[model samples]
Target chain A: MDYVEELKKDFRYIEGLNACINCGVCTAICPAAEVSEYDPRQIVDTVQHADNDEIEMLLKGDTIWYCGECLSCKTRCPRGNTPCYIIQSLRSLSIETGLFIESIQGRKQLALKRTIGEHMLKYGYCVYIDEIDTEMFPEQGPVWEWLRDNREQILTRLGASYRQEKSGALRKIPEESMKALQSIFDVTGATERFKKIEELSEKKAREMKISFNSGKDDYFRHLYEGHND
Target chain B: MRYSRNEVWETYQKEIADNNFYFARSCIRQNVLPAAEDLFLKIIGTDLGKNIYDDARQTTCTGIAYHSGIIPFETTMTVVAHLFALMNEAGYENYACSCVTSFGIYSEVLETWKHFPEKEKEAREALKKATGKTFEIPKNLVHASDLIYKFRKEIANRSKYRLTDTTSGLPLKVVDHIGCHYAKIFPEKGIGGAEFPYVLAGLIDEWGGQQVDYPERRHCCGFGFRQYLLKSNRGYSVANSKKKFESMKPYKPDLIIANCPGCSFFLDRWQYVIAEMENTTYGENGYGIPVLTYEELAGLLLGYDPWDIGLQTHQVAVEPILDKLGINYNPDMKYKGAGNSNTDSPEQPSSIKMF
Candidate 1:
């Protein structure tokens, strides 16, 4: 595939690029750049001139995964360029092409898909309190511990009707709303994208030495635990 | 586009909806800080005397999913289209969002529509086919805290607590943390723009607190959603907050106020993790600086009972702030019943000198 041609198709990718003077402001201000080797200037240069093979390497590389996506680059760029937006497009192409399965951090896409992706469709909420297992999230602290254990009583005390069939905050979504949401996902191609993630993740799992069985298996655990290093 | 470089902040002081609003809840707020929303509803509806509507049917904004690249871009746009349809069904012209992510996504999607009119037509047609509900674009889209900021003076007039410490008779020090999506994406949209947004600071001023200007004030609370979502990757998120905490530590601020639920969640939760990591604290003894949402701060000053307002749910204890203000809260009931007498209360901090 012509990587540049593929990127040119997304209007966002185009808006994100301007004549690069390469003042290094985005790289200097980027928090991810400070912590990780994710340099916006280098990525911009790489994309601006690199061949299809080089761009494909980026699509399957760790540098693309390092952006926190805070968009600080948008705020500081002298040319009104947004390297963050370009990263978004690169990340999108990476996922669609299943080249994301080639890298460690990119492979963690499967972990995010299984947890947040499935949760978004099923519970209609991201980061559901119940799903936050204490073993996974000991940092939520003891106060969270008590609150999670006594969720219904505590939420009721705070005047939130947790999971009750009522017309207020924290109520369970109705059946029709769920169907409508599902249909939106189906028609908008989110479901297809989701299937791609799962199918590719399973193939990637086989390639790795670790066994993949179910919820947060060894391979899943490795990617979820660290930058797919 | 509406802002002027010459003026102080006349641009952001635009009119906030007083009578009619379709309130959309944030999934993070609904799950993490339920009472913050509860107090918001009570203060706006009962105390402030305004009409607002919230329905169980409103779905999650899916901003997190979309930003994480789990949900396709088209799905988010169509879902937002359905949300607009819901607003039309509710017969409300103003959209008051509760989360920063939702607000940001709405801003992004609206801009998307502006840029790609054809894409807008596609989303509208998709929603029209799925739900058969048509929507007029919102007259104004705002964050819930912006409503409180708009009414800062009025809230000050109604509040029982002042920004001054009653017992000490000195002004309280406060640091304000703005969620990135709140105005970072569109600086003109936020109250004070990207560098100096006053949405929370306005409240601190009107309520009588000294707003501290700290280095790293513009930093993200490290709730880099996808990074923070991964268990092992949370160190980056915590380290970011560590930068903020370290920057502000020298100032000795009384509290940190945040507008975003995710900001409050991470800024609050990460303090404990940092303490565990570094073996030190930012406050007296083991305590850390208390972090609160604007609603929590407003409710506290408005004489709302702390426990009823869900102060107990906070990992960083708020009793010190309450004590500094000379506010009355049942000490034993801080963890037990909000108002009920405690049978087996959680251990209280040693610093408290019981009345």
Candidate 2:
């Protein structure tokens, strides 16, 4: 894939970078850079030099994945550079080029695709209470278990009409709204992106010998279970 | 408007429409802190006598997916366009978002459209073709907390409870976790400047709490949409949280108030995770610091019932702080519902004690 061409497609990424004197202040303030091997300065370094191979290597590797996108670098850059914006474009380029399929982030896309990506279309929420199981997230404690069991009652008491047709917070999202949401996803090309994520992740899952099924299957569990530190 | 990082806000100034608001509900905030939106509606719509429309017809900003890189910018922009179209159809111009991510995403998308006018055209065509609706860009867009900060003195005057714990009779030591998107990205839009955002701090001071500024004050709450969504990469999320907890542990804050739904959820839940991982606690005793959305705190200050606000659903037990505040709540209310019916007994019930 022509990684530089993909990066060039994003004007925001080009504008985000100012004259980087390479002072390394952004990397110094970056928490991801601190805890992980990700360095914003180096990513910027590769961008300025137009190093295609280095940029390709970045797309296929985890260094680009390591940005938390906190934009702390945006906050402290002496040259007014926006490393986080560059990171965003790189991520987009990675996905567009299918280079994301080669990295850990690429594999993790399936998890996000299923949980957040699908959850929104299905329930109109990114994080729904019913989907969060106590077994997977034991940190919620048994009180959450009780709340899960008594959802309608608790949510009602809190003044939200949970799953109800009436218009209030937590009400069952309207049918047309859901359809419009799906249409937005479709017309805007995000659905295609979601499908690509599914296709690529399925292949990756097969390579790992992890069978993929509908929900929380072997590969899904593996991704949900987490990856190497 | 040259939004320089060097600007210091001596007086708060921005285009915050005072009335006729279109309130956008947050997906996470509703699930985690349902009563927050309820209380916000109560305070603004009823108490303050403002006409705020929180239509159920509006959908999620799809921000979680967008920020996680599953959804691209153009897609999210189209989604934003649709939402704005809905708001425009409803005859509301002022947009107040309940979620920080939603607020930030709206701002970011609008800015992106501003930079790339053709993209805005595409989004408009997409929305108009799909929904048969047209939109005018909002005259004002602000977070719900920004409204609260704008009306802090009014809320202070109307509030039934102060920040002082009723039992201890001491002022609450508060830690405000301002979401990164709120200020870090665009400091000009944020209340005060990014470095010393007084969004939560100003409210805390007005409401009678002592704001504690720790070393890691500006740290993200580790809800890296991408990092945290993938379970294996959560260590990165926790590492950032660990940094904040370690830095704030010295302050021994009584309550944590945050504007961002994700931050509030992450800070509340990760404290428990961190405790289990490292076998240490950050708050008083072995429990963790109680985290509340700024709206939830506003609800509490307005003398809202603990159970009515769904405090029981919180992973980290709020009972400790409630007890410290001498907030009167029947111990049985944590288990039994109104009128006292039998329910299944759960294992390790943190919200309830067998008293």
Candidate 3:
């Protein structure tokens, strides 16, 4: 499918992939490299020298998802390269080709899509406080639960105009603005991209003989619960 | 690879607008740290007498989704363009962003537009087709912390207290954690550049605190949007914070100050998680180190009521630092609702001490 060709079409791939000197400066400074098996120098070298079949293997593998997107790598690359940006392009191609499901970390994109992506379109905010379930997030502890329960009263005390008509913290976005945001998503192909993620995730679930109900169902729970070291 | 710090820092200095700002509130900050934004507007507008405005029609920059790989870059660019259009309609040339992620994305998008004019054309056309709103790029793009750094001396002059321990008569040791996105992407866009950013340090320098430089000072707080968003990947997130905490422990800093909302959130909350999971603590006498946003620090220095600035919402007890600084607060009003209404306190954690 000419995966490398499709990746090069993105501007980040062009601007990010300057001549690679294989100096490993980015790897030394990368936070992900410290804790994980991920290495920016190796990823750049693989992409620079790998063949079409080898490139396909990388697109469907787990290495690309290891980047935390901190972009610390961008600041240190002596060759003027940004391995982080190249990783972004690789992730896009992986999702576009539906090869993301082959790896554990890459498959979590569905969970992110359902939570952060859907929330952006529906609530006009990325992380809606009301939607945070304590069971799903035990690390939040009891204080967050208390805060969520007494949200309106506490927000008011802090001078927040929560859910009010206009101005102040957590104010509702107007309907016209929501429509404009929706139109941007539709025009920029994000709406279709979201649909693609769901459809492919469902297909993968069927292949694995798992139940695939929509929105935090059995498959979503499986991916959300699966951890990678 | 060795060079003089002065020669390198001189090239990184960038101009910050003095006043007349159009504020951009963050999605997470409004939910997590609502007072952070409120205090910023109050400090900049009422106290400092600047022309800072917030409009009701503005919305999230969709940066969280964009960075999570759920949405494409074009969608983010179009959404950011809409934000600039709102600022243009409101008659402000300086854009002050509340979220570090949004600030980084804005900087990235603006740089992209400069390098690739065709992409900018596409974004303008897309904005016109969808919202019928036209925008001119902001004359100045600055993060909220940058603005505070610009006026640190003024804030210090008006401060009612210093970051000093009254009992010991010594300056409190402080750790400053700048968001990775703040300067890592483009060093020239930040105050002191990436390796050594002075935005938060400038505040500590002027406000009577010593800035502690640890081994992992530049490490990310590990709120990597994707890593923290997924439940399974959170270990990686917490471990990164643990790395920073371990490195800073030997220095024995009294408090940690973070400029990013997510950094403040994880650094504060994860201390409780670490204590519960590993039976370890970084602060003195079984207490976790108190992490405060830059605005929260400014508000405290100005003698704003503790509850009024939302210190009660933190997982780590702030009383230690407040006591160290000799600031007065009524323990009874810690969890009170609006107009002194009665409220219930959450069951306290067994590990870290809470008020």
Q: Give the candidate number with the greatest lDDT.
A: 3
Q: List the residue pairs that clash in candidate 1.
A: A104-A228, A105-A228
Q: What's model 2's TM-score?
A: 0.94
lDDT of 2 at B235: 78
lDDT, candidate 3, B116-234, per-residue tens? 99999999999999898899999999999998889999999999999898999898999999998899999989988998788888788789998888999999999878888888888
Better of 1 and 2 by DockQ: 2
- TM-score, model 1 to reference: 0.95
What lDDT tens digits, residue by residue, belong to model 2 across residues A1-229?
6677778788668767777888899988887887788888999989878888988888888788788888778888878899988988988888877778787656777778888898989888788888887776665666677777877666766678788876677788889888888888888888999888878878887887889876678877777776433
Q: In candidate 1, residue A125 scores what lDDT? A: 73
Alpha-carbon error at A202 in model 3, in Å? 1.0
- Each candidate structure's TM-score, on Cα atoms with residue i matched to residue i, is 0.95, 0.94, 0.97
Tens digits of lDDT, candidate 3, A129-194? 778868888887777887788888888888988778788887777888789899999998799899
Task: State how far residue A112 of model 3 sits from its true place (Å).
Answer: 0.4
Q: What TM-scores result for chain A when each predicted structure is judged separately against the true chain A?
A: 0.94, 0.93, 0.95
Worst 10 residues of 2 chain A by lDDT: A220-229
- DockQ winner among the candidates? 3
lDDT (C-alpha, whole model) for all candidates: 0.81, 0.80, 0.88
- The DockQ values of the predictions, listed in order, are 0.60, 0.65, 0.75
